[model samples]
Target: MSDKVFNKKIFAYIVAVVLSVFCFLPCLCLVEAEEQPSEAPTVYAADVSVTQGSGTYIYVYAKNFADVSGLDLFVRYDTSAFTLGRATKGSFISSALCDVNAETAGEIRLSYVSVDGVSGDGLILTVLLYSESEAEIKDYKVDIIVGDCYDSGLNSVAVSASGCKITVKEKQQITETVTFYSRYEDVTKRKGDEVALSFYTYNSHGFASADFEINFDDEMLALKSVSLGESLKNTDSATFSVNDKTDGYVKISYAALSAAPSYVTVLEISFTVIGDKDGQTQIEFISSALYNSDLTAYNGSKSIVTVNTEEIPSVIVYPKISLKAHSVTYSEVELDIFAEKDTLLAAGDFFVEFNAEEYECVDIVKIFDGSMIVGNTAFKAGMARLSFIYEDGISGDTAIARLRFKVLAPCETKSEFSISGSKITDKDFNEQIVEYVGTTIVVPHDFSNEFTTDEQPTCDTSGSKSHHCSRCAAVKDVTEIDALGHEYIHHEAKAPTCVEIGWKAYDTCSRCNYTTYEEIKAKGHTKAVAVEENRIEATCLEKGQYDSVVYCSVCNEELSREKKIIEALGHDYIHHKAKAPTCVEIGWEAYDTCSRCDYTTYKEISEKGHTKAAAVEENKIEATCLEDGHYDSVIYCSVCNEELSREEKTIEALGHEYGEWIVDLEPTVSAEGREYRKCLRCEHREERSVEKLKNDDEELSGCFGTLDLTSIVMIVAIMLICGVFVKVKSRKSNR
Candidate 1:
């Protein structure tokens, strides 16, 4: 072909392509520019009422949510009337990457992002608040402020935010009886011994103001000093005045900025024994006035303290039972019991009590190796008993036994062990004075609520995660995740032809290197259509011989060769003109042939097979969750440039692996619950209904007294908030 003609054809092709593109692009643009009808997302909170001294959860919901991928939301509420508790991610954002901050007073900030945007309506956040008992009965607002939100394209999404009102109702008042009393029993002290007595006040309603006047026998007991106790821990203003001029009275005026403890030590008074002879005197609270935060007077009692003066004993020896920690761990604890006596030679019996709910008794080994020896060691429920006798005597601090206990509640907890029903006898079998002291063991923090992934699993390597205590941040549980084996992709092999070398089929890892193969073998030449090479015709005049070669059609390689003889004949020559070569076929110069004889050779015209081919995709199908799909890579033929499709491949489907159930709606006394469990692989949800609420009056155990249906339901709602949702890392795949 002429260069000019080729240039013209190429120019025409360019113009056609440009025109086609111009014609089609505008229609696509028009379709893309057409907007879909949708409303802006609305974020709102729910109106709720809570009883005083109780807690309730506030939910932030989203409506008309469309194509929303991420949000940075803020909520504000009054902190004066309520204290914040746990702030958690709701079901709508359960699988989304989220961060929650409730550390700031009166404000909560939540940030969430999803790879595939969420739509429709659901809960986004849940916050807990405890209403102060002393807070005024009024309404409060929880507001959703303006925040940043975005769509899957990272374009800003306009969000309409609204807030809700919370009403705090007055709790039903239970009459609380407050008593001011001296808890001291009648005490005997030697002359000149200082008499110190403590007075406590018990007010279930919790007082903020109090005034007390105490009168002692001033003639026999001289007033020394007065000190405030734990009840005044919150006292913003307090005035204590001694009325020595009035002979026997002391005035204590107390006021607190906050409600004081319900049960606490109020005051301690010390007096000097001034009576010349042996006698008894009374230190009594003559009058008292106490008011709660509401200024309601607390019922009071006038209790007296009696001090008896007695001569010191000639031989004062006090038998003592003491406790010392022997060993302590996260799972077990041991305490050593000891006996101390000033006078030697004695037999004794001891009883110990512990909180059964916090610990379990494992073993008690007697440590006292003495004459006669110990007897009757027994334990039950919350108590342990041990008795021992002496043939001669044992005294002066001797270890009695080692008490071993298994920790039941391992989280940071306190267990108290008390000694009771203990008695010691002298060698003569005479009862002796004794004092028993109890001890408390506080366990270190252990695993409870939250878990963190320490290492992520790979295709070949395992991972580890640990559960930590919610309160103390101590690791209590450690777990290992199994390794995921290699995901393999099957690679089809290219078969060898008569002349071409071929590759052997092998599998390769999509995740990790599990198996490998690179071996290839040569095929024993399978014959294709054979082509004759270097052939000559027989002539008439002379005997003609030619070498005949057979070439492989598949790879154009010489396969076989043979020499053949032909009969010669006289030449009858004919002349042919030469032809020029063109792109479509080959041409040769002029040649001659004989008429009626095979004498002259004639030039032949030939065409060649195609040398290059570009691969094209055909019959493509995308893989789905339930079925496998495949596509083919079709390459062109060398000779005709027609498609010779090869290398068909398949994509495996992903099966569903579901996670734990997520509670969307909690069961109530009046309504059934709805929940859904999602597949971990694809985020597909399977929803189901839960059983209706049962009579759970027993579960309603708390400090809150008799409550109405609304308050009761609020309590139940908080209790039913289970920790079943597994917090996962950010997912990158789109659904």
Candidate 2:
């Protein structure tokens, strides 16, 4: 109230604070448009570009090594196609790089990453490189491959941009001259300079035809020669000369006579040499039938063979080629061709002539009443059917020549062919089928198979993986190798050979496989025989035995037993009286097991201690026959063929003595193994004894018993049957 009423109450509180800030400024602009709306998209930052991976060991992987922090990229080129390398704070991107953009040549390689993508807030780029302008500072060397911070957090990011082209990081050579302003009638003979014209070239594979000698680009206009046409290895050619006093971009003097020469392939030839009806200049030949000497440029389609020194001989027709067989009977038929050599000419044989007329009389004849083997004649095996005639020779247009042939059958078909029938030359049945294995080897037609873990044991590959199939079955859908095997064969013994029978044949790899091999192969003919020596011998052909193999004259070994004995058994009279084992005389029988105490002495062990009758095989138990060491169940008496002995006493040598006689022998314990008791005589009790023998050698004895125990038991059974129990067996290495 003092400074003018306090300035009117401070202007009335500043007009009530400007009417309360313009009444809340439209409710604060509707709450700031409901708090920050619109303007969003463009947030694709999970990698935008990066793809570099090429050859000779250049690798750089990145998916989540923290999105490569400040990951940069620079790469520059336009000096031609790539140069400037090395990075890592040397300023571009780094951590991986090599032999890259080696440096300038027609380059245009440019890879700048001033800021690639990858959001979720993780991306820092600052790479730059400008080419051909904007300060011409092409930067390079930055192989920055980075992504996957958990794959940039699922927002999806796969940055890749390494594609490269024009990759010949090595070649660059430049040579110019390609001139020859069309002129060659220099048929020389000149009088003093300036009229030189030589010219050359007639190529279409005919290589060199040199002549060249024509100049002048503008003195009087002359620029139509560019043919250095041939001599190559990567390629090169020549012919040039400009400055005829200028003014002839004769198409830039014919593109500087095929500009800068050396880039071969794409040679163009233009012509206009006419001197007779107003030479209207119209000759163009630009080479591209893939221009001979092997490619470098003629990028497809451009051969124009048109040189009509006035449309001469383009009237081709040739046709009328025949070799008909009025009625062919000799089988293999089909050869009908007739050519008049040029009657219109498309009957093939580029340069023709074909014949058969009546061909020389029945050569090796197979019904070919008249035959000169000029092309085809049949009969085969019984000789002559060698017909392979592609004759351009006018052979029999009608006089009857009918030449044609095609037939070749001998099928086992393919995995190198196999169908072996005759029980497969049984080497003991293929060594008993390579010692029992899940064999294989039936590729006789569905051929081509090569995956060798090697195992061909007498082959039976039960439908093949041929057993070693841990998992190898794609033999082209493998349908029929299955007769039943192949799921086992752990098969061992791998290299050099001893035994590895897998027979493994299911190999589609590089094909041509019949696989089925098992080889015990001691092969004298493979005889290990032992099924009772595979009997049924008589060259056994009922498959009973004898698949042919014989060769063991005692281990020269090879005898599944093949017959050869016209009449055997008499090596010195029946294997030397049947006493064998002197080791080799083909006798072999030698018996007697008790050398001393095993008491099996039915002996003839010929060291002769007690010799009697070692003879055998004929004792049908006769009165005079003998084979003394017998035991297959005793039965000796065939009429007086006596062997019942307890020390001979037929009624005491028949001297007859009757009475109560007891020659003491009581040690009986019989069960048929050992029983003996001779209680002598004592029996006739009261049965009419009218004594008609009053003094019959009077010798009736009484009973005295005190050991005469059968002569002390036959001398202790011959001293315990000559005791001995040994088993040495060193055998001197099969002596």
Give the top-scoring candidate (TM-score). 1
Task: Give lDDT for model 1.
Answer: 0.72
Q: What is the C-alpha local distance difference test score of each model?
A: 0.72, 0.28
Candidate 2 residue-wise lDDT, 1-735, digit = tens: 254664465556555654655566566556756775443212111212211211111122232232322332323233332322221121123332212232444322223222333222212222222122122222234343332322223343334444222222322121221222233332212111222222222322322111111211122223455433333211334332232222122111111212222333323223233222211122222211122232222221112222222212245443343333333222222333232322222112111111122121133122323323332232322222232122232333222123333212222211111111112111122211111111111111222454433333223453333222222332333333443333343344322222222232232212234334453432133334343333443321122333345554434444444432322221121112345433212333434442223333233433312223322233233221112232222333343344332221111122223454332333323211222232223232322212232333332322333434344444544443332111112222333
Query: RMSD to native for every prediction?
Result: 45.2, 53.1
Determine which window of 10 residues in candidate 1 has minimal summed lDDT.
723-732
lDDT of 1 at 270: 84
Model 1 CA RMSD to the hidden true structure, in angstroms: 45.2
Q: Per-candidate TM vs. native?
A: 0.22, 0.12
lDDT tens per residue, model 1, 161-207: 99999999987664555777676646677657788888876654677
Q: Which has the greatest lDDT? A: 1
Candidate 2 residue runs with Cα over 4 Å from true position: 1-318, 322-735
